[model samples]
Target: MALRAVVRSLSELCITVGVLIVLFVVYLLYWTGLRADSASDDEIARLHKQWAAGPVDGGAPGGGTPEETGGSPSRGQDTTGDGQAGGTAERGAAPGTARGTAPGGYRSGNSFAVMYIPRFGGGWSKPVLENTGKQTLRKGLGHYTRSAPLGAKGNFAVAGHRRTYGDPFKDFPRLRPGDPVVVTDGDTWYTYTIVARPYRTLPSDTGVLDAVPAPVDEAATPFDRPGRYLTLTTCDPEWGSSHRLIAWGRLDATQSASEGKPDALTR
Candidate 1:
C-alpha cells in the first residue's frame, strides 16, 4: 500500500511539472508575440503623430505623410533606384542628413523611423527604434546605435528577432538579392536594395556592422567600395540564437517627406 502511494505522488508531481512547462512555452510563443505586436503598432502610431507635429526642436519638420491606401504618387515626385528623384523633391534639412541628436536624432529606446519591405507584403510595416536592448526589442526592431545614420555614408545596421516578440524577422531567411528595404524618418525616405543572400555567422561576428563590412568566415562581401549600406540581422535556425543571419543592402534611392511614397513602397 505504501509503495502504491509513493508511485502516485511521483506521477502527480510529473504531471504538474509538465503542465507548467507547456504554459511557459505558450507564453513565450503566443502571448508574448501578441503583446509585442501591439507594442510595435503603438510605436508606429506614435511616430506618425510626432511627424505630424513637425520638427521636435529647430530641426526639419517631420515630413512624410501617414501611410495611405491606393493612390498614384504625384507626377515627377517618384524616386529611382539610384537615389535620384524625378520631380523637385524637398531636399531641405531633412533629418536623414543628420548624424547626431539635432532635430531628428534618434534617442535610446525611442522610435524614429518606420521600415517597410515590399516582399514582406503591402501591409507589413515595423517601427525602427534606437538601441537593441532586451526590452527595446520586445517593442519592435532595434537600431544598432553605433552604425551610420539613415542613408548616411556608412553601414546602417538594424536587428530584430526571428521568433517570438512578434517575430519581426521571422522571414529573414526569405529575403533575396535586389529586394527593396525602404525606411522613412518622416523627413526623408531611404530605399536600400539587397545586394546578396543572407550570410550566416556566429553571434560574435561584429565586423558585419563595420563601415565597410569585412568578410565573414572568409566569405567575400558584395560591397566593393565605401558606400551607404544597410545591414539587417536576426537569429538563425528559426528557433535558436546560436548563430546570426545577415542581409546586406546598398542605398539605392531617396524621396522627400513631401513625396507621397517611394516607388518601392507604392507598387
Candidate 2:
C-alpha cells in the first residue's frame, strides 16, 4: 500500500510540472509580441537625432501626431510628456543577459536612450517600455502620452517589479536619498536624483503618472514639484502584488555622457 501511495504522489507531481511548463510556453508566446526587433536604420538614426536635439514638443518618436490622453496629476493639464515610459507586467525573471535601459523611453517607433540601474543588477539593466493601448501595469517605465515631452516638462513616471520578472526594483528598497539615475537621449545624458519611496493602492486609480508627483507629505521643492520627477512603482509584499511601491526622483537637468558598468555589446 505504501509503495502504491508513493507512486501515486510521484505521478501527481509529474502532472503538475507538465502543466506548469505548458503554461509557461503560452506566456512566452504572448510576451513575444511586446518586443521591438524590426526597427529600421533610418528610424533608429532619426530617434537618435531627436534625442541629440533635446526635448521636442512636435510629437515624440513614433508618437504619430499628438495624443491628448488625460493624465495630469495636479494641474489637470493632460500632462505625461511625450516619451516612452511603458508598462507590461511579467512574473518570472526574463532569460538571457539583461539589456540596459536604452533609447531609454522613446515615443514608440522613435528610439530613445535608456539609463539603467547598473547598481540594481541584471534584472534592471533593461527596462521594458510599455504602450498606452493596454492597461498600464508598470512592468517597465511608460512614455508620456503627448504634450510633456521627454527632457521637456511634466512628470516622467516609470514602473517595475520588485520581486519577480527579474525584479527591477529589487534594490529599490535600498535606494537612498540622492542616488543617481541617468537617462540619455543618445547624445546628452539626463540625470535624476532619488528622493522618496512612497506607496499607493492597486491599479493606481489616481493620476500616479502625472506631470509631477502629488504633494507627498507636503514637501516643497523648486518649480512646484517641478523639474522632472522619476517616479518608480512596483508591487508590494515582494511575494504577491498586493499593493504598489512608489518612489520619486528629481531630474538634475545638467546631463553628461554615461560611462559605467555593463559596457557596450552587453545589449
Best by TM-score: 1
Q: Residue-wise lDDT of candidate 2 within 9-94, one digit each (tens)?
A: 99999999999999877654444224321222333444445443432432454333222211111111111233434221110122
The whole-model C-alpha lDDT of candidate 2 against the native structure comes to: 0.47
RMSD (Å) per prediction: 9.9, 12.5
Cα distance off (Å), candidate 1, residue 23: 0.8
Clashing pairs in 1: 76-87, 83-253
lDDT of all predictions:
0.77, 0.47
Largest lDDT belongs to which candidate? 1
lDDT of 2 at 227: 61
**Cand. 1 Cα-lDDT:** 0.77
CA lDDT of 221 in candidate 1? 76
lDDT of 1 by residue, 1-267 (tens): 999999999999999999999999999999999999999998898778656654432333323432211111211122222232222232232323332323224556777789998887788889998789998899999999898878888899999998998989888888999999999988789999999989999999998998988856666576878999999999988998799999999999998878879999877
Q: After superposition, how far is residue 258 of candidate 1 from its true place, in Å?
A: 1.0
**Cα RMSD for predicted model 2:** 12.5
Candidate 1, residue 65: Cα displacement in angstroms equals: 18
